[model samples]
Target: MIQTVNGKIDAKDLGITMCHEHFIIDLSKVRGEDDSTLQDTKLMLKEVEKLKALGCQAVVEVTANDMGRDVIKLREISKAAGLHIIASTGFYLAPYHPKWLQESTIEDLKALFKKEITEGIEGTGIKAGIIGEVATSKNKILQTEEKVLRAAARASKELDCAVSTHCDMGTMGNEQVELMLSEGAHPDKLILGHIDLVSDILYHKGILEKGVNLAFDTIGKTKYLTDEKRADHLFALLDAGYEDHLLLSQDVSRKSYLCSYGGKGYTAVLGYFIDLLKERGISKPQLDKMLIHNPARILDRAC
Candidate 1:
């Protein structure tokens, strides 16, 4: 097995591990916070220290192929910061694409992602260690999205990398999973991000049955749903026996949408998620299982 300093995990392990969270994401022209790219290595180290203080041993920085996924920079900064930083390879949201989106194909996208995981990322000197935060191109999980996800799903299976996605707001995960499964990607290697918006236990349960990992990634963004509602749903999901297929995180990256009014923006997103679990009557031991044990299993598998 591909073991780490820790042991194993599914999605949840109360000694909780955050599966997808961004310390900083470089959206090129779309600016938020200060410039936290490679130039701000000290700041990055400081931030990782905070996560460590909170007991986060690792963080998967699933920045996309077209976005600010600087693998060389990520390795240097994460190493200095003493965090097990795992980077990913895949496409991003449509808006973030360059002018070449008009001509890209499944093979083209796959070749680029393969190069990153194999050769290197943009010749930056550090290679991508994982697969995604892969988002589909379709408005819903349709043909275009399916094409990208199919390539990504297949690539992940071949490379033994985990695949995650930036899902549409209204529970588009069902369609997303359809593509991954169709492409022979084991659902265990796929994480459906943004499922908190699904709002139906039966809907999520059905999706979980397909065996893809579930990501409760938007934990601290309480404006859309109350903290109570988010916690209740999450706790209920844990109780629903899908624990092995879950991933916990605060998708606390700056995208103008989440930055209108905030402190350091991503700061305290982890803390907020942790506190909500406490308020919901979830004990510390259980929290560790969801956050810690399960995530380890998901990442270290098939090594």
Candidate 2:
């Protein structure tokens, strides 16, 4: 079964899921950016409603604890929007961690993650279904980020949940994957996010070689890379036989990234990017695997 904000459900119930997203978050504490704050539940629910209208059945909110994770609010949004919402546990990038995290040992961090997974997050009784958006820097994994990643690897191994990670501008994926593997994390239960930011097949292939799933989840952020370019890389990987090891999302967190704020809403992946993939020669079956099968398999923890 997969844990949702509302409760647990069979993996088959997690249909057409966007593997990475943010429904309610506040990154201002970390980035001091106004756009990063997704504070309005009403607005978030409206955006999610648009996604549901487009046939999105579930969304994995990758908002980790340090990234203003509000599981209580998420539960409300999930109920109101009628979308299965899978919440996350674990911290985000180094800057987002609390002061104690830097001094904490891997075992200390592991226990925290394990508690949230097995029990619930911060005494809310809303168990997290996944173990990340654990973030890393552009060139290297910082000391704190390393601790979190190793702890996440251990916790995910124990809890049997997927560990999704943020690859800053698409770097350090190889290192992150190697580190998770070194800690004996299941490769199939690992997701390396934002690789589409790099736009290099060889870079992606090297990380995929480690047998971890890749999230082409930064779709619709044309300022960084066009959706067409992201599709090109995705199709290339599919052609190379990595369809089962891939997932899709917009990674939409900032207010400006939402259509309500003049950006593509949560429905972009289902409403826009999927059509773009079809136009680019990606078959219906491949689209189904990325949007449905791949995420369901990774997020499900029925063992």
Candidate 3:
């Protein structure tokens, strides 16, 4: 299991957590730039150390099958960086991927994912740290796409890792969650990531009603709606009485892992969010529940 940045790990120990963020993700999109994609541990450690010092106890590094998710490297880097690392399993953006058609069934992909977790990923006896931060394109949900998600849901049910996904522009979260629920996945084990990009309050509420975790964190990118708005959304969700179901994070990564992102990455998401919340008048206990108790529970973790 990957350790937390501050060395306190366990479901309950993932305090002030960010549910789904990438530590270092280099997709095939960065193909033929192998040297550029490979991360330098010493440099990455600087960021990790900063996060640890800043109070980022844990982060779920969700680099999927196609999106440059590296369990071994993440484990090694996290250990050196002194952070507890949680890794994601599964594939990326089904519509954008050609392999979407290759799998005859999501069950097949589930088998592969299960094998990875149960047996080992890439020959490392270490299983995936989490089920997935799976993805699909905007309004382009295909038949197989639903199937793969359902399979992932089943796998998450079987394996006990948190299952999450990226949402499309509008109404996708609602559709996606319905699909997963139809397939027998527990709503409690699900995380609806990327709600910021998805623009619909009704859609967000609809998904939240399904008992799935609604993560409305897209901070650190000033170009985003604004911390005030992000705060508004978080509090609105909380005020709407869903605070227990929310999670937060920036999704930032070290520049080398991602060719883009000027690397204005977080040494500590917990530190940043706390400051933002306080400036916005959020109480200490309220903030604590959102970042600490809530995330631990949502991870379906008793630890």
On lDDT, the leading prediction is 2
By TM-score, the best candidate is 2
Per-residue C-alpha lDDT of model 3 across residues 40-71, encoded as one tens digit per residue: 55666666666667677667776677776667
What's the lDDT for residue 270 in model 3? Answer: 60
Q: Please, what are the lDDT tens digits per residue for candidate 1 over residues 1-303?
A: 322212223232323356776655676555444543323455566656766777676777777776676666667666676666667777766665666754678777777777776666776645665677777543565444555687787787777667879886735778888877887777787888888766787878888889877888776666767656777787887787776777677775553323323333333446576686786677766676567766666665453
Query: Which sections of candidate 3 miss by over 4 Å?
Result: 1-9, 28-38, 95-101, 169-171, 253-263, 301-303
Root-mean-square deviation of every model: 4.3, 1.0, 3.6
Tell me the whole-model lDDT of each prediction, alpha carbons only: 0.66, 0.90, 0.66
Cα lDDT over the full model 1: 0.66
* Lowest lDDT block of 10, candidate 2: 261-270
Over the full model, what C-alpha lDDT does candidate 2 score relative to the true structure?
A: 0.90
Per-model tally of clashing residue pairs: 27, 0, 8
Error of 2 at 106 (Å): 0.5
Clashing pairs in 2: none
Count of clashes in candidate 3? 8
Scored against the true structure, residue 283 in model 1 reaches a CA lDDT of 70
The best-first sequence of candidates by TM-score reads 2, 3, 1
